[model samples]
Target: MQIVSALSEISDRYDALFVDLWGCVHDGVRVIPGANEALRAFRAKGGKVILVTNSPRPRAGVERQMDAFGVARDAWDDIATSGDSARVAMYRGIVGQKVWHLGYAGEEDGGFFTPPNVLDDPLEIARVPLDVAEGVVCTGPPDPSAHPDVMRPELLLAKTRGLKLLCANPDIVVDRGDRREWCAGAIAKLYSEMGGESLYFGKPHPPIYDLARRRLAKLADVPDAAILAIGDGPLTDAAGAMGEDLDLLFISGGLGAEETGTPRLGDPDPEKLAAYLEATGVVPTFVIGSLR
Candidate 1:
């Protein structure tokens, strides 16, 4: 469906809103025009908004990024991220266990902060033996060129050691600035292809949504019907909302530009969108250029 009327139709029904960060609110560098206004309007109408993101960085880092883009923390009730989800997973108890971190050292430390034991060197983890190691937490995509190996030895080691792989971010890729780059999900996919088992903890998975809901519940009583999710990517935003039975508003100007066919500003062509949705089987409840 198209959005000709003010978003209040959906906004008024729901007491809280779960908004996606990257595409819907801003690109990696700047806020999308009208998005901030739309969020303000929603808040003025008494709706609580919780900004959710799949960024592998810590919540503080996410906040800094948002601030750089002009989206103040006051604009939203709370922010939920993949890093936060990972922290929750770690805290559930895996103490004194060695973990093989598959992402950059910066990201590993940021995403899985405060873990019982986090080892950046694959050799250190391997030497401990898989049986002694607690699990593998894949935080970001590995650089194949740098590693010079298509099939990472870490994956084989994990498989041989029978390690449990926990994917902190389930997004395969995301739009950053003007380019798309691989995420933790890409590494997780590679591991899975090599017959490794994994547990994903971000979008399109039920646990993240549950976490968002709990965060929203604190601000106001959120009804399933009134809540709406706006996002750029279908896999994480649209699919995740649909999985939770919430209405979704797709922003075509975000990630996977090929899927949206070089999105432009203003309203999208319905005919083109319908074809794309049909091909992907991920139809949104409504469509807009952006949240604005």
Candidate 2:
């Protein structure tokens, strides 16, 4: 992977960008400095940016979260969230009508139960207890700081009943301004390990990319070759881009900052970056310390 100084070096090569939110644009809690300006600059150049995120909030909720985080509206053209994509599946009754709602303990109204605009005949979803539910809809850990194994009792019961879990977000852990928290993917991974089926809809999965493509189509008919995927998650962003046959601008300074030896506003050490990428088994098209 080529280590680049800034996004501008390769921004002109693509007509659209499937930029990730939690890391590339914001550090989960707030807008990362330079990210908004970088995106605004790209938009001014006639490029469309789709904030393709694995956030467990619906697109509307995502917009609200962005607003609350002080993330500029002009920085992006549209959004495609894992919550919306998974909600479509949930409303379609992929996990049956009576399912358990697993989400963050104190997260705001995330619109996870809202019907997506795409469905014409959506089923009524009811959140039931795990012992009596048909399936599980896991948005994330009930407590972000708690260990994922804390929910093993519920998952074990669900597995015994042969329930399929719809994992809304596929991120294992996210750094919320230096505090790392477990996500839905970790719960789903544990479930799968315990012989329960976990259905993923976000990054590293084709469903979210398909949703993103539909959203991008509204703004421009950009080809995959002309659309660059930017994110900090090596497994989600890098793997998703590779799976979708799209080039990636891996932002190492977000999640793997320490591992890659990346400063807060500088490029990663080439040798350390190489070793990290090798360990992760991902080769991004380009690498940048931050969005700028």
Model 2 CA lDDT for position 192: 97
Cα displacement (Å) at residue 203, model 1: 0.6
Give residue 232's error in model 1 in angstroms: 2.0
Among all candidates shown, the one with the greatest TM-score: 2
Report lDDT per candidate: 0.71, 0.91
lDDT per residue for candidate 2 within 131-162, as digits (tens), equals 88999999998898999999999899999999
Scored against the true structure, residue 14 in model 2 reaches a CA lDDT of 96
Task: Write the residue-wise lDDT of candidate 1 on 10-107 in tens digits.
Answer: 56666677888987788778887777877888888778888888876666678877888988566688878777777566556332246666665444
* Model 1 regions lying over 4 Å from their true place: 3-10, 94-96, 104-111, 115-132, 144-151, 256-258
- TM-score of each model, in listed order: 0.85, 0.97
Per-residue lDDT, model 1, residue 71, is: 84
Q: After best superposition, candidate 1 residue 247: deviation in angstroms?
A: 0.8
Instruction: At residue 224, give the lDDT of candidate 1.
Output: 82
